[model samples]
Target: MRPEGIRLLPWLIGAVDLVMIALATVLAIRLRITLPIFSAAGDVLENTALASVFFLGTWLVLLVYSGAYEPHVFGAGTEEFKLVVNASFFTAALVATMAYLMQYPLSRGFFVLYFPLGVIALLVGRLLSRRVIQRLRSAGHFNEKVLLVGTPGYIGEIHTVLARESWLGYDVMGCLVPRDYAGLEVTSAGVPVLGLSEDVRAVVDEVSPDVVFFTAGAVSSSTQLRRLAWDLEDHAHVQIIVAPNVTDVSSERVRIRPVAGLPLMHLGRSRSQLATNDAKRAFDVIGSLTVLALTWPLLVVMMLWIKVHDGGPVLFRQTRVGRQGVEFTCLKLRSMAIDAEDRLTELEARDHVLFKSADDPRVTRPGRFIRRFSLDELPQLWNVVRGEMSLVGPRPPLPTEVEQYEDDMLRRLNVMPGMTGLWQVSGRSDLSWEDTVRLDLYYVDNWSMVQDLLILARTVTAVLGSRGAY
Candidate 1:
C-alpha cells in the first residue's frame, strides 16, 4: 500500500521547483545589482521586480510544458534532470525572444545569471528530493502496488529485480503465472501467484494494483497483449507496462521504432563501438593529473607511513591483465606484509575469483586503515596517467584469475582496467564472483563519460563509508 502523501508527489515537486526558481531569481538580481563585474546593468531594480515575477511564471510554465513535473520521471533516472535542463534553455530562449520583440528593458547581466543559476538550483533541489523519496520507499512508503503477469520463470526474474531495487518503489502484490502453474501457491522468486493470465481483468480488479507488468512470455502474441491493454482501458488509473526480454542494457543504447506498424526495439552500438576511446583517454589523463596534483602530499605521507610501518618497499606492483588481454603492472600501496604472497597458498580463499579476505593475517597495522578507505589504490593514478589504465572501467584481474575466464568472460578485457569501477562501488570484496563478472561486463559494454563521472562521485561515498572493504 502507498502512503496518502505519495499522490501529492507532483505537487510537491512543483512547490520545490517554485522555491528554487524564486531563490535563483533573487540571487541573480542581487548579484547583478551589487557586483560591478558586468558593465551593462540597465534598470537594475526599477523594472526588475516586475520582470522577475514574469520570468518566474514563464520558467515554471516551460518546465510544466516540458513534462518536468511528470510523475514517471520523478525519484529515478536522469530524465528529470535532463528535462529541467531543457526547460531552462527553453525558458531562456522564450524570454529573450519576447524581450527582443517587445524591446523590453531587462538587465543583460541578470538575464545571463538567472538561467544558469536556476538550472543549478533546480537540479540540486531535485537531487535532495530524490534522496528523500528513496528513503521513504526503503521504509515502505510511496510504493506502487505491482501485479506481475508472466510465466513462472519470467515472473521470477522481474520479481528479483524489484526485490533488489526497493528504491524503485514497486511493491509486488502478487503475480499471475501461466495456466499450468495456477495451482501453485508461489513462484520460485516467492511472488504469490494470484491466478492465470486469462484472469488478469478479475485479478487486477480484485487487487486494485497501481501497475500491471507484462513480462516476457506473459502472452502468446502482440495481438493478445494489445487486447489485454484494451480490456484494461476501463481501469484508467492503472498503468500497464511491458517489460521486453532485453536485460543488462542501458536505456541510452536502446530505442523504439515503428517498423511496418510493429513496435521494434533497435539497439545501438556499445560505447566501445562509438569510438569514444580518444575522449575517454583524454578525460583519464586530465582527471588523473588533477587528482595527483591535489593528493600528492597525502600519497607521500602514506608512502612514508607504509615504509616506516615495516622496512619494506612503499609500493606494490602486480601483473594484471588489461585491455586486449595485455599485461600491465598495476600499482598500489603495499597494504600487505612483504611475505604476504608466501602465506597465500596456506590460506583458503574467501572469494573464489578475487581471493579477498575480510580479515587476512598478512595485513599490516596501517594496511587495515588504508585498505578500508581505498587509500591503498591512490598510487594507480600514475598508471592511469601512463595510459595503462582508465579512470573508470572494470577491475584489473590477476594473471591467474584471467586464466580461468570463459570465452564470454574474456569480453571484460575489451576495455582498460581501472583502479575502481562498478565492482568497487557496488560491494567491492563483498560481491560474489558471479556478481563481480556481471557488473564488470555491464560496465564494459555500457560506459559513457557521464557514467564515469557518476562512478567517480559514488566512489567517494563508498570509500568514505568503507562498506564491504577489508
Candidate 2:
C-alpha cells in the first residue's frame, strides 16, 4: 500500500467502528423498545431515537480520544481492545450522568443495553479487521518501514524479532551502527548498514523510514538523544522509538515514571515474589472441578484403554517438583510400558533437560493417540483439585530435572506446578531447552488472572493442532 493509503487505515477503522456503533444503536432500540427501526412513532420513541444519536456521537468521540484509532495499535496487542472497552464503558457512564443531571427521562433499559452491544460489536469488528490486516501484512502490505540505530548485536536482536513476527508489520529497511563499526556492511541478522549511528538524523532523512528505532548503545549519552530528537523535529512523519534491553516482560508490570525529563521504567514484583493467593487458588479449584465434571467419562475410557493395551497400571504416578521445591505425585494416564522408567537410562535423550522422543519404543498403541491430543494430561486435573497444582503455571519438572536446575531456573519452583502452562501451549516437548526455560521464567515473572485465561483458551487450539506433542 502507498504511504498516503496507509495513512487512511486509521480512518478506515473509524468507518468500520461507525457502522458497528450504528448497528448496536439499532439493535439496542429494537431489543429495549420492542419496536421496528424508528417506526411506531411516539414521544418516548422519538426521544430515544434522538438520544441514540447523542450516544453514537459520544461513543465515536471517546473511541478517538482513547487512542483506539492510533496507527501503532492498528492490528496488534491488547491495547486496541482495552481502549475500546474503556471508551465504551466511560461513554455509558458519562451519558447516564448527563441524563440524570439534566432531568431527561432516558429509557434506562436502552441506555444499559446500548453500551454493551456497542462494545461487543466494536470488539468483533476489531478482531475481523485484525485478521484482514495481518493477511495484508503477510502479503507485504500495510507494513511500516523501520530504520534501526545501535550496536550490531543489539540491532540484530531487534531485527530478528521483527523478522519473526510478520504480523507486527515492521519491515527493516536498514540500520546504522556505531561509527567505529561502520566498516561492517550488514548486521549479523542480515540487516544492511545504512550509515554510522552518530549520523542517525541524516540516515533517517535519507532512508525516509516510517519508524526510527534506537536501541541501547545508539547514542553516547541522553544529551545526544535529546539533540537528535530536536534535530529530527523537521521529519514530522518519522516516529522515534527507543528500545530498552529488556524482553519478555508484560506491559502490566512496567510503569513509566518521568522525573525531571527522564523516563524511568519501574518493574513490579514477579509472580513468584507475590506467590499464589486465595483468588488464584479458588480459580484453580473451580476450573479443575468444572473440567473434571465434564470429562470424567472420557477419563474413564482412557483409563480402560491404557489398562487394556498392556494389562498394566491405568494411572502413572511419578515424583515431580512443585512449589518451593516440594515433591508431589504427578499423575497421568499411562502412556508407556510398565518398564518405561527402567529403560530411561538405556535410551538416548533427545533434550538435555527434559526426556522425550516422538517415536519412543516404550509408547504403546493407546499412548500415541492419547499423547497426540494430550488426553493423557486429563488425570492431572485431579492434582490441581488437590492443591498440588494449578490450572495454569510453569510445567512441573521431574525430580531428576530439578537436580539440574540453575539458580535462575529454581524460580519456577516458587509457583505451584500446573497441569498445562506456557510450555504446554507453546510447543510441549518440541521447544528447545533454553526456550522452555525462558518461557517458564517469563510466566513466573508476569502471571496474571487474565493471562491464565488466555493461555487456557490457547491450550485448546494447541492441543487440537498437536504441533509439538510427542
Scored by lDDT, model 2 comes in at 0.86
Q: Report the number of the highest-TM-score candidate.
A: 1
Where in model 2 is the C-alpha error above 4 Å?
A: 1-57, 74-76, 98-141, 342-347
Q: Candidate 1 residues 1-470, lDDT tens each?
A: 33467678989999999999999989998999888788755667777788888899999898899998887898776678889989999999999999999999888888998899999899878877886887799889888999999999999999988987798899999999777776998888888989999888999889899999999999988898888898899998788999999888877888999999899999977676432368888988999999999999999899999999989999999998988888999999999999998988978976476788887999998899889999999989999998899888899999999888898799898888888888987779888898889888888778877677667866886899898999
Candidate 1: clashing pairs of residues? none
Q: Write the per-residue lDDT of candidate 2 for residues 157-182, one digit (tens) a residue.
A: 89988986687788999998888896
Name the runs in model 1 displaced over 4 angstroms: 1-3, 26-36, 40-49
- Give the CA lDDT, 0 to 100, for residue 221 in model 2: 94
Clash totals for all models, in order?
A: 0, 0
Residue pairs of candidate 2 with colliding backbone atoms: none
What lDDT would candidate 1 get against the real structure?
0.87
